[model samples]
Target: MNGLPMVVSEPGLPAKVTIHEVGPRDGLQNESGIVAAADKAEFVRRLADAGLTTIEVTSFVPPAWVPQLADAEEVFAAVRDDPAVSPALNLPVLVPNMRGLDRALGLGAQQVAVFASATETFAQRNLNRSLDAALEMFEPVVRHASEDGAWTRGYLSMCFGDPWEGPVDPAKVVDVGVRLLETGCWQLSLGDTIGVATPGQVGALIGAFERAGVGVDKLAVHFHDTYGQALANTLAALRLGVTTVDASAGGLGGCPYAKSATGNLATEDLVWMLTGLGIDTGVDLGRLVATSTWMADRLGRPSPSRTVRALAGASAGEKQ
Candidate 1:
């Protein structure tokens, strides 16, 4: 498979893409059942073994806000102590505000992510603050995280369309993204929170960011597969030289703020496409499938990832 002919869809597709695995944090936060800290630790270890270098391990938000991740400290400690997990693995935890940052810092977190919204309505609903106020809230978090020498990521949600606002302008999205970058965020992840973006909208948004002097190197994409356009939109971003892509294992997350939003792009599905394109991700598709399948059993449901389903089905057939 390594010797396969390199296939470039466009003139300058990225030689490799970075997959930011967000399953343990973004994926599990939306889950109805609270996963045990030990289980979450095992999940992260499995992802690390599967070659997911950067995994969002957990969120430092208050338990009242996200009970599923209430055991953030325990989960982080467990994974940190596991000798089997690579020491080089980047485990980023979500830190919503100063309090969250304090908690993550106490845990000796090496990386953290702050989330904001592209539209005013979503901002008010998710963060309970206005657009400007939400950005202000993250300013200190990003600054302190940077000062502490921790890698910081800024997430801008509802970049394409908001449920209340309908269609979003690409210029507005770029402006919000630039603000996040200016706030000391090392990287900005533009999110299709409601999964409303198409390839054309994605291309336009990335192009606008580039025109605004925000290089693709400082940008990543987080697409939800609500409309089955996550992979398609990702392809568009990759063609534009956006290398970092955020996905969940087993397609296991949704936006609690945006009710219509569904699961994220599955890591297995993304890996299949990247491998087919001869793009290096350093991920093992079979191990990823096994991890997701194990997680799905814990959730008491089948994985939403088509790649996982196909692979699992083939494995079952072989035994039969």
Candidate 2:
């Protein structure tokens, strides 16, 4: 119940950081077993109560593609109707194409995102289209969504490396990113799909985006802890003025389509580091740990987040 880290704010980093929580959607989408829409709605309510302002609630893709989220409409409707879940909460959902967008907007979804790939192999594998073709596909989708005034984000996966195609070119990543931004996406989230990027590569990619005239205000970083570099890369991006970072509770959620994509940067772990650095994320650490623990029990597993495990265990010892 205490903020342990002394306020040692780094000079270059922002005073406040926005964590885009994706556990509900990204984390559960990979689950083979069905998580009931009721449980999913409760999870979203718990996250909002724990002070996560922006939670990716669910996806609008076909049930055939992500059967786990087949009840997206039900889940969204439940949360949208729940009195406890704040109306101001940003509940963005993933939409694969125009049809998906139509479905999402039909249910009164406001914030939506389109997923893209930095590598051709991943584009073909994930989207069943070439990299440029996928970007082209997103153009009209993004335009249509923007015309409706939906806050759209473009998620460019494999920004660092791909399993089928290794060592992604930063220029290539920037090209796709620029095209997506030009298509009127409000933000671009560069994903380290395989979690292989180090600090230098993270800085270089952001720098390349800068060279292409894209600033940090329009950028966010989505890193996986597969190689234990997520935090480090996040730090690098923070120093480069990236204010928004994507994370999942309990270190959950890899890509359902990309087997190589491992666990996302845990929200608890990211909060711990940000707290240590004197950065404000507006998350209650104690409640956040408990919320993750609650979800972990529901999932029949322990949370993978080092912070959640440590803090939860410490609190348990205190109770004893």
Candidate 3:
């Protein structure tokens, strides 16, 4: 303790971590009731105001397939006109096929995402095809988007474990990740679809990617909190220099394939941990918690964030 400055010993983690909020797309997709277009726009606006830089605004799949997102075009239109959410930040839409991509491009989206699974069983259930066929189907979409200079993110679901297939091979994940990169996607998000990955497993999978010559900077992590391992696993990825993390506000998401699976890592929970560890997530914790509260109210449920619950309890006590 002699003579060393306190600031030198307690320096913050890195100054930047990109938070790709998937509340609007991933969160609402699995919801039973459809969220109104206006409500959805307001939700995104509130998140943006709370300092989320990159938001996954919507998906362009057909209405029949996902009735929850039937108002995709309307929601995109609303956000496009919103002064709070501007072009300075990004609003990446998930497009399942060329038609979805066309709709997204028409709405002036500068960024888009495509979805694929690492294992055959999940792929069949999700995309109704083999792994190779699903990847081949996105070729034209990726090619066109790249020509237009739009950034694309490819989601590789069940990178560590698949509910149907049990455990996923690390090399299989690498093959899909490489194919996506070769198709010109700027980033690939490896998902823990069932939320069963431990920190050690996360490190091993990330190490596999490193050995395959995949730059850590081009990777993102989407973790489910089913078993309460999301944040711990996230810390592991951060330690490996993977900066981007995908989270859903209000902890809203679950995999239909895994019955016991919980939501994506709560945005509020992740922000709290990052800020405490001196990591910069560019997200305001209090406002994010407020937004989650609002959504929980709308859905008639309590918030799932442990940090939010603790803060709320303290606030109530102070008020009393």
Find the candidate with the highest TM-score and give its number: 2
> In terms of TM-score, how similar is model 2 to the real structure?
0.98
lDDT of 3 by residue, 1-320 (tens): 11111232124345678899999889878888988899899899999988998889889998887889999999999999998786787899999999999999998999999999999988888888999999998888999998887888999998988877888889999989899878888899999988999999999989999999998988999999988999999988988888899999988987655565779998888887777676767787777777877877787778777766766666667779
In model 2, which regions exceed 4 Å deviation? 1-3
Q: What C-alpha RMSD separates each model from the true structure?
A: 2.0, 1.1, 3.8
Per-residue lDDT over 1-320 for candidate 2, one digit per residue giving the tens place of the 0 to 100 score: 55355567778789999999999999889987898899999999999998999999999989999899999999999999999988999999999999999999998889999999988999998899998899889989888888888989999999999898789999999999999899889999999988999999999999999999999999999999999999999999999999999999999899987897889999999998998899999999888889999989988999999988988888888889
Reference-based TM-score of each model: 0.97, 0.98, 0.94
lDDT of 1 at 301: 95
Considering TM-score, which of the candidate structures 1 and 2 is the better prediction for this target?
A: 2
- Whole-model lDDT, model 2: 0.92
How many clashing residue pairs, candidate 3?
Answer: 0
Q: After aligning candidate 1 to the native by TM-score, how far in Å is the CA of 153 from where it should be?
A: 0.5
Q: How accurate is candidate 3 locally (lDDT)?
A: 0.86
| lDDT string, candidate 1, 8-111, tens digits | 45557788999999999999999888898999999999999999999999999889888999999999999988999888889999998999998999888989
- In model 3, what lDDT does residue 239 have? 83
Judged by lDDT relative to the true structure, which candidate is superior, 2 or 3? 2
